[model samples]
Target: MTWKSLKTVLASLVAVALAACSPTPSSGPEATVTVFAAASLTDALTEIAADYERDEGTRVRLSFGASGAVARQVEAGAPADVVILADPIWMDRLAAAGRLDEQRFDLLANSLVVIAPVDAAASQDVFEALSGGGRLAIGTPESVPAGAYARTWLQATGRWKAVQDRLVFAADVRGVRAFVARHEAALGIVYRSDVVGQDAVRIVLEPPPEEQPAIVYPAAGAADGGAEGRALLDYLRTPRAAAIFRLHGFEPVA
Candidate 1:
């Protein structure tokens, strides 16, 4: 081959080698934030996650269950980036174990309610209905925060002992709502947020201040969570997310 032609061929070969060695361009910033959320937050978080995914190109993989159960899963080393719970007790436990990246804060607040199946007689008097000794559903007090609140309210109003025998305990607030919705229980106590879109039941009572216990949903980043997880936690506290929480009948805690 002529010298110039050979040199040209060698230059072409070098260009191809350099092209092969170059790193591929990144498609985009895509990540998945694994979140464990309380059952009551199902609707709101799912909606907010859609917005987040669209805006950040980050997928939020959510797992919803009872707050206590979800907390236990995290404690047991379940791979979780963020946790939003219905109560702060579990958050405290996580903090105690040094499992949180920072101090947790209240994400949302909710109120207790008494509900009855739609087909049942309208009983505005929850205390009177429970006093009648029919099955009354509530979350199990030992672990479920809502159940503990219901028990507290019952005791404060002097209704617990009178109706304790009639109590049909459930695993979570959603379970209590389900019991009332399916007509499996004559009455049930659950968070107001739990019954927002449910049509099978109607609110019978909104507990008076004296009977209503404080309800707060606390959230925090898992200790092992990376930057994406921290970003997801911050997003949850934004005004846009707060508005969504309000739409779901939950109050944002300042």
Candidate 2:
């Protein structure tokens, strides 16, 4: 080959090599924030995650279950970055175990409601509605946060002892809803968020504050996690998140 032609070919080859080495546009900022949260937070969290990804260019994967179950998962070394729980107890346990940072916030609050099968009569008296062998579904006391709240509510309302025999324990609030939907149970208690858009059952009663424990959802970041987790924790405290929470039937923590 002529020297000039050889030089030109080599220059083109070098240009191609250099072009290959240049960084292409990033596939957006890639991040995996594993959030273990209460199942009741599903709708709100999904919406918040979409908004967060749009602004932060990160992906959020959420796992929803009972708060106590999530705490156990974290305790077992699950690689969760953030935890949003339906109650403070589980969050406190993780913080006490040094799994989560001391910084935590009560993100939102919710109320309890008794749901009945679609054909059930709408009664003015909440407890009396469940009389005459009404099968009640609630979360198991050991692992479900909502079950604990329901029990507390029942006890405070003086119905726990009367209704104990009729109680059918479920693994989680979702399970309780499922049981209620299937007619395996005539009545069940679940978070207000869970009953929205549910056509199989009707919300028969909103538990009076005197009959229920106030439901609070708290969030915290992993103690040893990076900025992504902390950023999410901070973002959850923003007014934007509060608005979203309110939109999903939660009471904003202000």
Best candidate (score: lDDT): 1
| C-alpha lDDT (0 to 100) for residue 33 of candidate 1 | 94
lDDT of 1: 0.87
Candidate 2: deviation at residue 168, Å?
0.4
How much RMSD separates candidate 1 from the native structure? 3.2
Clashing residue pairs found in predicted model 1: none
Off by over 4 Å in 2: 1-14, 17-29, 128-132
Global lDDT of each candidate: 0.87, 0.86
Worst 10 residues of 2 by lDDT: 121-130
What's the number of clashes in each of the models?
Answer: 0, 0
Model 2, 43-161: lDDT tens digits are 88999999999999888998988888888989888888898888888888898899997668888888899888888766667567557777899998778888998888888777889
lDDT of 1 by residue, 75-135 (tens): 9888999988888888888878777887367888899998899887765465566554579
